[model samples]
Target: MQFVQQIPGLLLLVTLLCCDSIRAQDSSNMANMTSMMANATNMTANATSPTNVTNATMVESPMPAQMPMNMTQPQQQQPSIWTTEELVTDLSLPGAPNATLDVRYNDSLQVTLGNKLTPLQASTAPTVCLRNVSVGCEPPFALLMVDPDATSRQNPQFRSWLHWIVVNVNSTEKLHEGDQAVPYNGPAPPKGSGPHRYVFLLYCQRGRRLQGSELAPEKRKNFNLAEFVNKTELGPPLAGNFFFAENP
Candidate 1:
């Protein structure tokens, strides 16, 4: 009888132990679920944060958008202005090379191609200068002033009427400082000659001394520029530029 009573007590004790184990398991599962929910809430908050949104936007933006507002965009370069040498080349003068001829007159007034000048204004000797040359440089050259539209524009019988001639002109020196073979006689176009082209030619002296007496100033008409260059032994012209003038 005592043994049977002891069995019932043992059975009760086993049942209570099982209940305690089940309660412990339920408490552990609840704690794990709470932890998971907290983690999920933190993740949701981070996704909606302003700083995170800004970072994401920056990552998706183009390169130009990231630049400062005041920054300037790259600009294309423009074409350059015409130089003196380039203007001479456009004339298509035979044997005349291109050079920088800066012509000024009447108190530094710039003279360029197609520049209209009254015979009176042109009569005054103009100051001529050379630029874009080396320092302490002196290269001997010859200068000639001629009218391609002499006598008449339609039929130029006396084409290239020599007006002025200067020899031994150095690139560093002015035209007046050199040897003036023929004195400057500004444009004297005939009344009906229309607008005449007074071409100025520059030639290299090639280290030879030239005398003003060698040229016959009296015979200025019908002068062929190429023939004169050959006779004088002056090599092909270094450069040439010209201006326009008409009878007053």
Candidate 2:
């Protein structure tokens, strides 16, 4: 009996040891699986993150396919600033006239308004001509000479002193070639009056003739250029030129 009891105890001890071993093996296997999962998760995070392998630096993510991306810089369009039309407006010479218009005082002296000229040289009437008046498409025109800087530059008591006025002019003739509504008078800026602007404006009319001869003002002081042009029904100016003169 004693021997049989001892055999049972021995079998029981062996069974307990086997159970302990199996529990330890299961714990070890669970730990290995957990480690493997952690490593896999770390690899996935590195792949998805915005980091380059070479520099290990963070980088910006690329734009999505659905998003609009501007790859090129915007180009600015430049406006035209150096044309005859722009220059006219800049100089406050607004009117309508022949497109192919040019003015010259003498063969070598071209008239570009606002240029400087000696008082003595600009005293006489300048020569005016047309580009293609011989073609016969030219309309009747007129000319007016005024001094905006009359009396003095700082104080223009006599704002616009009319120097000359003429009508029935065409490209073929000089300013003196036209009918002398007002006889030409040279610039006579007073001493210490500073430089004066002598403006010569050309105007257009529908018909080639004036009904009756328009008498010009005897005195050239305080002449209203706008009023004269409008009252006579002269169309907008087509071309104009001017010069500056100072008393010697």
Candidate 3:
């Protein structure tokens, strides 16, 4: 009886040992399967997520069509006042007569004359003659004459008149008898008269003589008109400025 009881006990112990071994083997297999599943999930996530490289490149690059053009800055312009070159070019009128005179003081003055006159005329009595003078009288320091053709005729009531006349001019100064003066003469178009040219002339000379002395002694003695110009080097009898307008 005792031997049989011992055999049963031994068989029970062997069975328990076999069950423990099987349980351990099953736990190891489960752990291996779980690790394999985690690896597979990581690979799937990597494939689905957006790549950092391509996205970064897209953000940095600009579309060629959207680019702007490089532009240059604008330049500033100069004012319209007369320049020495322009003044000289305008003063050299074609067919203008050359007078016997020397320009002193400023070359700019010569340029001023050149820019203001029309073509020259050949008459001893300049196309624009000095008024109230006789044969022996000397030319004023600066004289100007204008042809009506060069003036504006915008207003009928406001006629163009002599603009400037510089007196006591140096006789050494010469002008193309028909050139215009600073104080140019305007066309005294008769009422209802057709348009007429006003001549302008410029002269330069030395010393101021009374308008009286500038005239022929015989003429000065005969005409008792008030002196048009004084001995001072002020200017001509009329205002020394020019403008254009139509006869009223």
Candidate 4:
């Protein structure tokens, strides 16, 4: 016990050295902790940054392929007025004309599908452009203008009164030169009758010509268009246009 007591000075010196070394080691550990915390803060900031996030998103997912021109793009179609109206049934058309039938009167009044007109306004013959109106008619065309609504739209007693008919026409400039099945007659709706629908049809004759003679007055009344179309060997109508007329 006396020998251990004699070594107390050496033990005190060792304790002081040990404490300084521990302080040094603790300071070093604190500095390392601060450095690690700063590194962690920088990593979090970069992860949240827009540029890094965008870069990460780009790396994770590739771009999609561009759409082809023929896919769904070419499926879009132009609108047609004939297809919108009930006259498609009377005309016995397979489809509305790809090229519209444009009818223009002398007064610059136009008939487009189901527009209204007075008996006097449509008294004179109109200028009808059939087939591809933007270009012109190439094939021989047969035109038939008739009143399915003869007396009134409801009654239709005197049904399908033939107004005009021209067959084997190529040019729009001279419809008179074409074979006239029936001379042009102005619309005559009976007084008190509400309105009458006059339909004009154009059938493509292709290369063949129809030598239709001038129709008798009796043949004008009850003129069966569908039967005439079948008898004449004309297929579905190429184009059609109609307008309403009635007595005031």
Name the top TM-score candidate: 4
Native RMSD of candidate 1 (Å): 9.3
- Stretches of candidate 4 exceeding 4 Å from the true structure: 1-79, 107-109, 130-137, 214-218
Q: Taking the tens digit of each residue's C-alpha lDDT, what string does model 3 give over 1-248?
A: 89997998999999999999999999999999999999999988776678844454445566567545776577786532223223212323222323312222222222223323222221112222333333243555545433322223333232223334444454322332222223322234445443433323343343434352233223211121112223334232221112222243
Model 3: lDDT equals: 0.37
lDDT of 1 by residue, 1-248 (tens): 99997998999999999999999999999999999999999999999999888787554545564667799879986432223423323333453345546666685666675577777777866777666753232467778877767785666788768888888886544754588888888888898668887767667777776887777556787877767777888765555556777764
Model 3, runs deviating above 4 Å: 1-59, 63-143, 150-187, 193-241
Give me the displacement of residue 78 in model 3, in angstroms: 9.8
Give the per-residue lDDT of model 2 (tens digit) for 1-248.
89997998999999999999999999999999999999999998887776646557657999768745667768886532213324334223444333333555555566665577887776667776655444233656777777866787678777678888778875445644778888889888998788887777776766666532564875788776667766787756665666778976
- Residue pairs clashing, model 4: none
Ranking of all candidate structures by their TM-score, best first: 4, 2, 1, 3
Specify the poorest-scoring 10-residue window by lDDT in model 2: 79-88
lDDT of 2 at 49: 71
RMSD of each: 9.3, 9.3, 16.8, 8.0
TM-score for candidate 4, please give it: 0.61
The 0-to-1 C-alpha lDDT of every candidate, in the order given, reads 0.70, 0.68, 0.37, 0.76
TM-score (all chains, Cα) for each model: 0.58, 0.60, 0.22, 0.61
lDDT of 1 at 199: 69
Instruction: Return the candidate ranking by lDDT, descending.
Output: 4, 1, 2, 3
